[model samples]
Target: MMIGTLASAMASFARPGVCKAAAAYHGPPASNFNLGRILRYPNLIGCNRSPTKKSSAQLQLWRALTTLTKREGTVNGPAGTRFSTVADGVIAHNDHAASRIAASVARRQLTCTMGRVNYDVVVVGLGAFGSSVLYHLAKAGLKVLGVERYGPVGHSLGSSHGASRIIRMAYFEGLQYGPLLKRSMRLFLELQDELAAVQGPLSEPLFLRTGMLDVGSVFERALCSAQVQGLQHEVLTGAELNRRFPAYRVPEHWRALYQPDGGVLTPERIVQAHVGLAQRMGAQVLTGTTVAAWRVEGTGADAAVTFKLVPTDATAVAASKRMSYSDATATAVPRNVTAAAAVLTPGPWIGQLVPELRELCVPERQVVGWFEIEAAARSHFAPNRFPVFVLEETSGGAAYYGFPEHGQLPGFKIGLYRHLYEQIRNPGDLDRVNRTANAADEAALRSGVLSYFPTAAGRLLTSSTCFFTNTPDGHFLVERHPRYPQVILCSACSGHGFKMSSGIGQLISRMVREGPKDTAAAAATNTLQPPPPLPPSAPSPSAVDRHVVQGLPQMDSDSDGVDWSELLPFRFSPGDRPGHREALDRFS
Candidate 1:
């Protein structure tokens, strides 16, 4: 990296820089920027810390460019550096400055800074779900607007940054996820066609559906679940498992359940594509804008929860590094702001948004790193030959999952699930989870992987952590926002929800446009919804029953993140009479 680029970067921060205008905004930063710490994302400390050597080298290159520029004084032609390539200062990668420049330029190019008008719908949190919601809303011809705290396609934080995510047909998680997964497959195909036709940035067809294994010492539930759902699958014995994937050295008692129609999904790219489609369809997408609260007015005033907006500044970026946040310089309530339908998908921030979910949503810091492997073994990890795997009891203690080698993330990609840092009080507050691993933690995880793939362990190359928004029951939460019919919330994906994103987005649009006729939309969607408000002193729905919500694993005691208002705008009480007709008219 060059000093010149560094100087330029710092210099650029001057000029009355455009600071982030939101009290709560998010996005990725210079390469390994941990905005998760800023957003108090649940498990940020897990995946987004260290930078790859490649990023270091890039920084050095920038510095060198700056020096050359100074030495040359002024030049019309080659100053040895030009802002044309994808690696130029103008085209920032993980750098906050670059993301800012990119966002700034995009705003100008797309006329993004125009005055905001009203719309029918406003979407926030553009990860997997928000982006898709925007696309469908736009396609359905609704005046829609979207606000993403991160830069275009996401600021490079959260569980969505990775190259590939596994997609499967026979979900072991349960049949509840089967329909959505299947629909997502269809949407992905549709996306491929739509993107190819647009003839712009090309996103090719997704990886082939080779298959996947849910190899666990004590569980065959995934296999059974698939069978019960009538999905095609196979339970391979010791020899069969080894034969299908020789690299896997399964123990005698251990076996593998293979879902042949399963494969990989381009996770990060999926976010970009959906949002891109939405924007192209005329949905106003404001990157680097946070959803500061809003005012839900009207007879549908139930949509009263207002979302505030904010932009990024230099100090804002620096403070975010320390995992802190500043207030927004400016704020606006979108014209289409949904008083009701808010999808709270703050990946690791489950603790922040719905602290009650703390019990259900354990904020475990997890990591994923690439291991360099030989060519022969590459096939064993290839998208076609190598089935995406979630090996639970690999003679190696590591209960991890892996995808085919893609991009620079080396080796047959592997990551340990149990090796993750345990639950913390909060993901953002530094004092919470133990980002630093103790000897026991390392040994536990290391021993786990080492035990199973003895040779593979030796090849381990890189590692990074990610948070899981888990549901105690290991399902997902795609329900209406408590106390409000217009607001909907989506969260708790357990460990795997990236694959069904296309379908999830579709359902969001379907529900917004078609109302409750969107039954398949609900099944295809997963989340929790709170009942409408009752008279004061009324017990919470769970309180009236004297029993906790069932199927949930466990919950935290000090969960202040859940919206704890005395009365919901229009909560959904179990015994409450049907108010769907009125609600539909308002939303429609």
Candidate 2:
């Protein structure tokens, strides 16, 4: 009987202008209609269009009814007759039932419109490097998404959370970094100005120019790099350094190099700024979510990288509360997102994500501490008075770096490079180990402070632990993955990467925009040759011009013809150790 009534109503509504208004539907309320059972009939739900041609209005009504039926799941009503025909070209149902069906139709339409999950590029980490990539990609008008494991952009869980980091033009590692440093400094300043224009002025500046002082064995290298790069600097004995900055008490025998361009950068602030500005520029960011697995699908131009996103424990709990899911398992379901390309900058977690480079990238534990300054010595340790310094106790001995008291922090910041020499084979071990500063770590930092800045080592105010994603050669790995060219592997900065993150971001963005280079020939030959050098008369901008340029040019064109592939190659050979100079031939 119910089937007969529904059939009759469908036939009547199919006629032109038969049921134009609710008043026309004056038959008995079809409140007890069995949608679950009716769905089995092909003709009633307009699924079998081949049987007969149906009116546009009839098709619309039937489609809405089918959508409502599937979404609400067996909407139960009376089993007996409920729908009835009252007169010619008229049908009727309860007003409440009519409104419920309309609501369901609206919801189904909304769901259909809001289900797009495709992007041009997806950055798989929101650390210093990843955030910058996201911002640059978004600024270039690409649809980009940034995924972060931690809840906040600048959370302390990763390597980018230190309050302050050193930024200097005179790189002691190699002269190859000169071009990158110059470009990065320009970008950092431009970012500051851009943020000020959009979000008003920041309370704290992103880069602070306090200059940098390098002492001991590193002095000669720094001085040479500074001279070659045409940077303004001063060469002084330990006594001259003490005379210029009263806070230090260096041994008179040690030589020191001071470059006026070096300064301190607020790491947390830079990360946050990049993320916030990226979001404002239409970049999507997913925090408290992690990528469980990812792969490249298809080949050539049709290739796409898909990532499976799983919420962390904290994210799952928050989502459950907001959604009111009865079963916790429902909220834990993983979602997949597809992108044309992906940039992997997961920091220490890079090894876990890409097992191919596990041995190449290792995470080492590090500790940093802040020591209170004496009341009378506070003036000398101020940011304006004292410069950031790196001291080597003996030639090629353990080196220590420190920053003058600045920001809200209560003491002068100091840390030992590769502190404790504790290596973490498994990235997950970081979570299990104690993160608090230990007594032994504090004692080591205090000893360095006593040897150098004795006046600032009054008391231990606070301390924290962080990790360095180290490469075997103490350089960085900035290249596409060996197996998947669509996926770029950018990790293992060996502790001094944060400063060059801006330039790195620009490099990755250009790679994504131009599509992956065709290195198949090189792979086929199994011989990767270094890029050729620029002509002697090539017009290269000076360091000063690079720093103040209005429009930052591409790294290839503006970076003094430095080939990044030679500086940081992607090839990984186990047990094959290449000297730093071999990798960076420009410096040699």
Candidate 3:
């Protein structure tokens, strides 16, 4: 009885007008029909079981017969409209084939209707990492959606809005990052080129290759890692550094490791580029929308992540501009979005989205200050003349990093690693935190500038505050949830994650594509023993370094020469505190 009723309903919708429209519509070629994707629509099929290719193709034809029957005026009208031009083209081009398939679909009692849309993957948080993930996934031909709580892709509300972020290959944190950094640099360059080819040449390149200097305690570790990775670097005394750049006033005993590949990446531009390319590749992006909650439904292959979206004021305003208030209200109503998988890269908001990580991935407030350079020394602080540098104070306090004068922003940009040591217990508190430079913040930055480059220090020009989502161990957490494998978590990159955002984005895309099979394989080989103790006088290698050194080459043939095992140390285990005791860490 139910089958007969559904068949009658489908037949009623398949009117002569539908056939006429199907014949007249010019859409994608018949060969481009994706029956598998069409069959994956459980609501349309009225069942979740996978159908054979023959049955899937037949059901797909049925979907077109029913969906295209809607009034011609309703095409592309609302969410309820289900007209698929591609499906119509298939039916129009292969009338006999589609008729036979439609007969089979009727016999099988297959039913389809316009319903809530689903995506192959949904990336929450369109910040640096999430934007990159969205681009890679879309480029791979997956149906993807990127959701950002803020307005647009490069909003200043998040950590990715800064004008300049340091990108260096001579990693002082760990040797394992060398390959990732190299890959990220290559990806960034490729991204710039790709955007240039499409959007035309940019006013300024996405990345600027300003040589970098690493000083203080981590200098030796950086030098060692540089040598191990075969990176081009130079070790110079404080006097040699000052003489070479004429922007330093380090103690004679202090030594620095310099690498020419170190440079600056425009965070805002990079994020926008990734999002723009992703959109060009058919990735849907929702700005001013927040994923209030998410959960996995079903088990195994049938599992799907459903996110409840809540619109912010920005979304409401934009919606109001597009339609009537009633229509906008209806549109703004919270809806559930379903996806095969989800990648969460919400930066400081990671804790709010993934409660399990709330305590582990803590958000800390940080400030960056730009100081005007003296007229006489302005040329010395130019990107070509000065190099990005990280100076570790002799007193073992916070390290200060600075960039040469670049971008429209005036003055030389400099920031302390954990400026003011302000840790936000609640992510919401970030809104209340003062974003402008305070007197203390200015004084601290000025003090560092005076100590290092006295000649360049002039006056406080501008300041901005952003959050650094730090983990207890100060390493990135890039892994699937402990219990929910369908939900991937990529956050808590400590403070220096921007440089590697592109590479991490690619890695997460692979993780989503490989799914549970590769995840299980990684778990089987997760026999990661703790690193051997180092001498008291020697700095301990990071967990990443130990993993890379213990015969697990950072790059392998699998997944196009990216060894997933290299990330084992960063995995979220039950009680494992990664790099907790190893205090030897540095920020970009």
Cα RMSD for predicted model 1: 21.0
lDDT (Cα, tens digit) per residue for candidate 1, span 196-302: 77755554654455677878752476765555445456778867787777666767567778876667776666676777766655567665555444545533422
TM-scores for all candidates?
Answer: 0.61, 0.70, 0.74
Q: For candidate 3, lDDT tens digit of each residue in 1-588?
A: 443433343333332222321212231222222222332332332222333422434354455534533422232345443321112111222334444434433453332223333677889988888999998777655667888876656777778866899988778787667666766776788788887887665445888878889998779888876766655677899888878888678887889998777789998888888887777666777877878788887776556778999876663335311210112111243488877778999999886886666677888888888888888888888888889988887546779999999878889888998888788888677556677788898988888888888876888888877889898767898887766787888988789999989888987887876665566776686444423433334432332222232222354312234556556666755456754223212100
Off by over 4 Å in 3: 1-117, 314-334, 523-560, 574-588
What global local distance difference test value does model 2 have? 0.67
Better of 2 and 3 by lDDT: 3
- Clashes in model 3: which pairs? none
- In candidate 2, how many Å is residue 266 off? 0.7
Candidate 2 lDDT, 504-544, residue by residue in tens: 88777766754556343444553333124444344434343
Task: Name the weakest run of 10 consecutive residues (lDDT summed) in model 3.
Answer: 320-329
Query: How high a TM-score does candidate 2 get?
Result: 0.70
Model 2 ranges with Cα > 4 A deviation: 1-117, 315-334, 518-546, 549-588
By TM-score, rank the candidates, best first.
Answer: 3, 2, 1
